[model samples]
Target: MPRFGSWLLAVCFFVSGGAFAGTTCPNFFIAGSAPTLDASLLSRTTEVCHTEYVLFASGVTKGPLYSAEHLTAAQIAGANSISRSGSWHQETGIPTADRSQSSDYTNSGYDRGHMTPAGDASTLTSEGETFSMANVVPQLHKLNAGEWEKIENYVRNIATQQGEVYVVTGPAFDPTTIPTIGKDNVAVPAYTWKAVYEPGVGAAAFLCTNADNYTCAVVSVDDVKTMSGVDPFPALSATMKSNPIGLTLP
Candidate 1:
C-alpha cells in the first residue's frame, strides 16, 4: 500500500479540471485492484484514501464517485466498540475550488450522506475521516435516514456473518442532467447503490433511488457497473458479475 503521506502530497499537485486516471489505492480495493471509471468521469476526479476506506472524489460533482472498503468481522467488532465522532469537515488535501465545504450543505434540504458510513469505521479517527466532504453526497433526508440506512446495516451484518466482505457504495447520475445543491454544486444523485462481494459466496448490489418515496432492489454487480459507469470488481469472473445471489433486504 502507498503511504498516506505520499498520497496527500500527490493530491496537492492535482490541476483543476484535469483527469486523474491510473490512480490506485490497492489497500481499499478488492484483490488490490481499483475500480475503473468511465472516461467521462476521469476529468476532475482523483483517488482519495482514508484510514478505513478509499474513494474517488469528483471535482465536477464535488463529491465521491464511490467509497470502497475491505471489511472484516474483527474490524466490525472494533467498530461497534467505538462511539461515532460527528466531526464533518472538508478535505484540505483536495484543492479548495475542487472540494465541497461543510458550509455548502447548510440548509440545503439535503443530508451530507456518507458513501462510507461512519458505522463501518473501527476507530475514532477512521470514523472522523468518513465525514470528509469528499466522501459525501447530497442525499434526500428520507432516503438517507430510511432505506439507505437499512442497506448500510445489512452490509455490516453480512461482514459479521461471512467473516469478511468487499463493499462499494456510490451515487449514480444521469448523463444528460444532474441536479445539484450548495455553492460547490455537490450532486444530488438520482440513485445511490451499494455492492458487496463475499469471497466464497457471490456478489450482489442494492440499488436505491434517492427520493422521499425511495425504493431499493437487489441487483447484479454488472448492473451496478453499467449504471454507475464504474466496475467495482474487475478481477471477478463473468459468472460472478452475471449471476448475483439474492441478499435479503431488511
Candidate 2:
C-alpha cells in the first residue's frame, strides 16, 4: 500500500483540476521488476463516450487516458504506447458502464472490451483510476462489453486468489502514427498488445492483435526470454520468474 499522503495528494489534485506533470506515464514495479505500458496520450476536457463496457476517446481528445485531475499518456512510441492509471492506496477512477444506454449499442456485435483492463490496473486504486476517460479506447463492442470484460474480471478474481497481479496494455498501431476515424466513423487499428504478470506463481502472459483480432502467446516465466518482435517484452528484472497459464483469447 502507498502512504496516506500520496492518496491525499491524488484526491486533492483530482478535485482541484490539476494536471500530470510528466509526459511519460507511471510504471508498475513488481517483484523487483518494472514493466512499461501502452496507451494513447492523455487529454483534458475531451468528450468521452461509452458504448457498453468499453470506453473510447472520440472527438477532440488528447493524451491516452484521463482522471479527474491528471492525464495518462504513453512513454515509448512505435506500434504501441503505454499509459498508467491507478495507484496503491486509492481506488478512485475505475471506468464504469453507462447503464442509461441500451445494451443494443453495447452487446452482440461489440466486444466487451476495457479501455484499461483489470490485470493492467492490478491495485484497487489503480483499477479505479482506469475507469477514467483518459485511460479508455475504442474496443470491439462485443469483446469490450462481454467475454473480454469477463477475462479482465477473471484476472482480478485470480489476482485476489493468488495475491496481486500486475498488468500492462496498449494498442499496436499499424502505421505507428495515431489513426483517425473517417467521415464514416469507422474505427481502425494497426495492432494491439497486452501483458500480465502474477507474482503468486511468477506467471506471465502476452497477447497481440494485428488487425483488431486477439491471439495469446502463452509462455512460461522462462520462455519470455525467447519472445521478440515489433513490441518486445518490456524487460523483466531478476526477481521476476515464472510461467503463466490459463489465458484465453476473444
Best candidate, TM-score: 1
Provide the TM-score for each candidate, comma-separated: 0.90, 0.44
lDDT of 2 at 226: 21
lDDT of 1 by residue, 1-250 (tens): 1222332232222112222255456877667878767777777777777788998888988989888999999989999999987688888767778999988889998998999999999988889889898988888999899988988998899999999999989988765568788777888887788989998898988878788888788878777776777777877898998788879778
Write candidate 2's Cα lDDT for 34-142 as tens digits.
Answer: 2321222232222232211123232332223221111111111110223444332211222222111123224334332344553343234445544443454445554
Give the poorly placed runs of model 2, Cα more than 4 Å off: 1-27, 31-113, 117-128, 176-178, 182-188, 206-250
Could you tell me the lDDT of residue 28 within candidate 2? 36
Clash count list over all predictions: 0, 49
